[model samples]
Target: MEQKDQLLQKVWLWSLLFFLVAAFTGFVYRWGLIGGDILGLRMSNVRHAHSHLMFFNWVTPVPLVFMARHLMKTAPEAYSSLKWCITVIILIGFASYPFFLIYGYHPVQIGTANLPFSVMLSGLVMIGWYWFGLIYLKYRNKADSSLSQLFYDGALVMLVVSSLGAWGVAVAQFGNIDNNLISGALTHFFLTTFTEGWCVLAAIGIFYDLSKKNYSLPVDKNWLIAPIVLGAPLMFPFGLSVDLLNESLLWTAKFGSLLVGIGLGINLWYMARALPSRNKVIWLFVLAMLALKVTIQLSAVFLPETLWLGQHGLRVLYLHLMLLGFVSTLFFAAFHTVNTRSSKAGVYLFLGSVFVLIATLVLISGLWPPAWQPTNVYRWVTVGAILPSIAIAVELVVAGYSRFKQG
Candidate 1:
């Protein structure tokens, strides 16, 4: 049992390494696209690959593994199946994503739905999470009552819900619904639910667990759960109706964002009190970046023109803000606090975050006109991007080596 546990730990850690490599490659390719060309790689292919690997392979695996570890501890009898389920999800993600990158969005038809290789893998993951849900439902009574646990439960549910976006595309093929708005909205639905719902919930749960373990900040599972849980899923309707402009959905989006803002503000307040012992600067930056992420998400309701940005190139900037600025930073904090291992990579993480932010800012600034910017701003943005890539690359190596050394 002990050996198997250690092996599982290694698999999860190695997944992080793979995520770093894939993310670095993706960002570099993105910069290359901006800078006219890098090695003549196909931009679409790289973008497809980058998003798949980052979304499927890297982001969820980390939190899933951590959450599974906790579940197994509380319900030892279910350990064997839980372990296998997670391993299978990881393997399927690792195997399937490269094909998507190479094949573009090729989702084959089967009955009422298209079954792309990527979507198939996602289906398998959804199965894994179903078992996860079962574990929770069957054994939750054995666990203590806490908000963290509720958040974790919500995270698992959201993870399962998030996969439907891919399946919806498959379903659309059969339904003969091929309009770009509806299709794009569905895709956005998945990304938003996964990021704002599953990822955010897991981060909160893990953050709470870390703080409780430290026994310093008396973390409470307060009424804030109301807002967070209520808000996260409500705005998902926004994605389905993004272009249609329904009055009900528009108002729902506004209300949902308000609830989310309140939930997030509460979390931020508690987190700020706990910040001194955290990798203070990095965590605070994460909070700020998270605020920015929420603001961007809600911008469509506030400034209707914002809805158009997703189809525009601005979508890339939005994704980078969430993936790099918010999700990744909080992920590191979760690992740091949960494992109680002090790492020297905070500086790298912080600097890399700043570089990525600056690159986004510069790129979005529209290069501001030829005379005022003189030098090609896209080229400069690419240059700034190199810092984060290098810093993150180093941070990956440091994290992997340290974990390996400990094992």
Candidate 2:
């Protein structure tokens, strides 16, 4: 049983590695080293590959694997089938990344073929998440009353909703064959729903669960349910009405963001009070989370059209801060904390990665001008990339060693 758990953990870790690599490639492309034309299909292909790999293969799967192992501890009979479902989901998600890369390069011709692969992959993920959600719900109902149980239940629902939103995107791509408007609507729906609803909420749930493992605190019932209760009404209308994507939709997303941010703030404050005064790593993680929440608020207000930053650059920077700086860093910290033999090393790795990530975003968003000065921008980005890669590599090695020693 321990061996099986270790194997699953490795799979989850490798998925994170893949996500980091994909994210780095995206940063490189954004900096204009790899792709020649910013507007060309090749750039689009790379972006597509980056998005799927980061979200599906990297972010979503890691939490799924962690939750699955937890489930196996109590409900061993369900383990085999859940593991199989995860394997299928990962394989399909992996296969789709290359297809996205190809489609990006040959947008007009290869996209047709690529769309089917994406559809199939999205379908598989939805099914896998459904199974996982059912398992979580079953476990939550049976488990002892705890904050972790609440988080598990909440994350499962977010996962299912996110998967369904992804499927909506796949369907919208099909809509593109006839009308670009419908396709655009679906794409927007997918982005907002997945990012705000599933990705962010699930990350919070994981953080909540990890916090409970370390200290006892009352779960904020409002924060736990705010994303779904608010996000659903905000996102559901997007599928049915194309007009919601215009300007009015911003209010809903902003409101949801405010609620989530307040909730996170309360939780983090509680966590800080609970932690020992010497834990700088946890403090850094909390600050990163606050930064992310602030970034989300900025994006909600200025995205697709900020005065100084422009729409394109602001969107990219917003995503970078939230995903790498906020979500990924917290996850790295939590993982290191749980597996404490290398906790110090893990904190170093996480902090180093975050510093590089922030530097990269600042250069990309603050330095670049519309007139095209690529020399200094590329150099700084290249330098920024090195820190995080080395940090994450050290983290992976140390984590592997710690796990092995335990075995």
Candidate with best lDDT: 1
Off by over 4 Å in 2: 1-8, 31-41, 105-115, 176-181, 212-220, 227-229, 232-245, 275-283, 295-310, 343-347, 366-375, 404-407
Best by TM-score: 1
Summing lDDT over every window of 10 consecutive residues in candidate 2, give the lowest-scoring window: 235-244
The parts of candidate 1 lying over 4 Å away from their true place are 1-12, 35-42, 76-78, 107-115, 212-222, 236-248, 276-278, 295-314, 340-342, 358-362, 365-374
lDDT of model 1 at position 11 = 56
Cα lDDT tens digits, model 1, 1-407, are 35335544565566666666676666677576676554666677677777777776677777766666666566667666666766776777677666666555567566998666765675676676676677667867776665567778878778777778767866775588968766766776777778778888887776665553433434456565668767776666555533575667668767886787778877777766655365666667777877777677667557764535334445556667767777777776666554445475744565565555555554554323446663565666666555665655666667667677776
Task: Indicate the TM-score of model 1.
Answer: 0.82
lDDT of 2 by residue, 212-239 (tens): 3456446655564565546433543223
Error of 2 at 344 (Å): 4.2
* Candidate 2: residue pairs that collide: 41-104, 45-104
- How many angstroms is residue 146 displaced in model 1 relative to the true structure, after the best TM-score fit? 1.9
TM values, all candidates: 0.82, 0.80
lDDT of 2 at 383: 65
